[model samples]
Target: MTNVKLLLSAHRRFNDLLSALALSADIQPFLAKVIAAVEEFLPDSKVTILILNQETNTLHSGAKNNLPDFYNEAIEGVEIGASIGSCGAAAYLNKTVIVENINSHPNWHSLLPLTQKANLHSCWAVPICNSSNDVIGTFAIYHHQPKTPTAVEHEIVNVAALITSVAIEKRELEEKLRFNASHDELTGLFNRAYLNNVGDSFISLCIRNNLNCSILFLDLNKFKRVNDVFGHKRGDKLLCQIANIIQQQTRSSDIAVRFGGDEFIIIMENSNDLDGEKVARRIHQLILESVSNEILALDFGVSIGVAMLNNKPQSLSQLISRADQAMYIAKRSNLGIYCKP
Candidate 1:
C-alpha cells in the first residue's frame, strides 16, 4: 500500500512539472524546469534539449541540466546521420535510440570527443514530433555510469518529446501564418498591403545608412492583347511565369511584389554592383528569351521603368508616382527598354 501511495504521489508531481514547463512564458525558466523535472522524476542524469534549425538542417542545444556550457557549445552543429550519436541519430531516424554504453557504441564513436569533454557514458534520445508527426527536435538523457534504460525511463522520455514537439509546432505555424499574411497569393511575393505597412521603416533604414536602392516598376507589354488573344487562364500562366523570372533575377534580400494586374514591383536593396539599368536589361532579355524570335517578330516584350533612392523620401506617394510616370514613358517609347526617372 505504501509503495502504491508513493507511486501515485510521483505521478501527480510529474504532471505538475509538465504543466509548469508548458505554461511558462520565460524560455530559460521553462527549460530549467524541464531539466529539473527530468532529473527528479525520471533519473539522476544529464538532460539536454536540442532544437532543429530548419535552414541549416542541423541540431542546436537549447537547454541543459547538469551539463557544462562546453557541452552546449560542442553540440551546436550535430548533423543528422545513421552513425551520429544518440541525439543526432534519434533526429535522423525519427524515433527513440539508445546507446547503453556510449563509449563502446558504434553510433557514438565519432562523438567521443563530445563525450570526453562532457563526461558522458550512457545516452538515450527520442525525436520530438509535432501533431503532424514532423520531427522538430531530439530530447536526450545522459547517465554518468553506463546503464540500460528501463521501460519507465523510456516512457518519461516519450512524454518529454511530446512537450517539445508541441512547442516547436506552435511556433512554426505562427510564423507560417504571418508570412502568408504579408505575401501575395498568386506570386508568393510581398503584396502592396505589406509594402504600404512596412515600406517606410525599410526605406528609412536604407536612407539613414546611406545605402543606394532601386525600385523597378514593371508592366507586361500589351497585356490587354494577351487577354484578348489568349484566354484569361493563359494570361494568368504568363503572370506566374513573369513572377518566376523576377524571383530568379533578384537577390534574396530584394523584395518582389505583384503590384496588381500585369504590374510588378522589385525593391533592389544594397546595390553596389547592381545598377538598376543592368537588372532591368537582364529581365528584359530573359523575358525575350522565354518566348522566341518569332514572338519578337510579333513585337512582344516587357517595359520597365526604374527609380533610385539617393536621398530620403519626402513622401512615398510622390516617389512612387514619379516611378509610375517613368513606366508610362517606357510604354510610350515602345517595348524592350527600361527608363530611369
Candidate 2:
C-alpha cells in the first residue's frame, strides 16, 4: 500500500514538471522548477543545469538549486574537456558521467576544492541533446554522501534532460522567427515593416523627452543603370556595401533601415540639423570616392535629404514627405545633398 502511494506521488510530480515545461517561454525558470521537482523526489541532493556555449566551447550555469554562490562562480565558464569534471565531461562526450565518490574520482581531482567547499560528495551528469541529437548542455545532480543514482532516479534525470532540450530548442526557433520578420535578409538591417511599426513610438519618445531628432532620406543615383549593366548579383553586392557605409556613419542609438529598393533611411535620435547634415555630407563623399576609385565599372552616387524635428511635426508622414521633397530638390539641382529650407 505504501509503495502504491509513493508511485502515485512521483507520477503527480512529473506531471507538474511537464506542465511547467510546456507553458514557460524561458528555459532558466523551467530548469529551476525542474531542480525543485527533482529534490522533492530525491531528497538531500543539489541540482544544476549547465548550457554549452558553442562560440567559446565553454559551459555556463543555466540554473541551480541548493548550490553555494562561491561554488557556482568557480565553475562558471568551465571549458569542456574529458577530465574537467562530471558536467564538463558529459557535455564533451555527449554521454552520462557518474562519479560515485568525488574524493577518489580522478576526473574530479581538480574540482575537489569546490565540491569540498560545498560539501558535495558525489555527482551524476546527463547530456541534454536537441532534435538533431547534438549535445547542447548537461543536467547534473550532486549528493551529500558518496552514492550512485538508483534506477528510478536515473530514469527521472534522463526525462528531465529531454524536456530541457525541447524547451531550449523551442525558444531558439521563436527568436529566429522574430528576427526574420523584423530584419532585411540581404543587409541584415531593419526592414520597412519594422520602421512602419515603430515610427510612431519613436516620434512620441522624441516629443516627450524634448530631444532633437532628424531623418535622412537617401536614394542611389543611376542605380537602375548599374543593375542593368552589372547584373542583379553585382547590384545586390553594391547595395550591401552602401549599407555598411551607412551603418558606420550612424551612432548606435540611430535606426538605419533599408526603406526600399535602392533607398535607405536613417532615423537620428537626439540630433539636430547640423548633425544630420554632417552625416549626409559624409555619405555623399564616401559614394563619390567609391565611384572615382572605379571599384565598379559604372558611376555610383547618392542624393540625400535631411529633415529636422525642431518644429514638432504633426505626424511621421509629414516629416518623411518633407525629406522626400528635399531629396527631389537636391536631384533637380544636381546637388548630392540638401537640407529642408
TM-scores, all candidates, are 0.75, 0.83
Count clashes in each candidate, considering only residues at least 3 apart in sequence or on different chains.
0, 0
> Highest TM-score, which number?
2
Query: For candidate 2, lDDT tens digit of each residue in 1-341?
Result: 35456556766776776787677777777777778877877789888888899889799887766798999899899999888799989999999999999999999998888889899999999998889999888999999899998777787788778877878788888898899799888987889999889887787788788888888999988898787876899889888988888988888778889999999988888545498889889988886676634533455668999888875554677778888888988887889888996
lDDT of 1 at 92: 82
lDDT tens digits, residue span 1-341, model 1: 35455446556755775577566544566667667777876556888888877677799877655788777777788788767888788888888898899889999887788887778899999988778777778888998889887766676667766766665665667678888888887778888988787666667777778787777888887777666776788777778888888999998878788888988887777556357778888988888788645434545668888777766454455556666777888888875555554
Give the winner by lDDT.
2
lDDT, model 2: 0.84
* Distance from true location, Cα of 111 in model 2, Å: 1.8
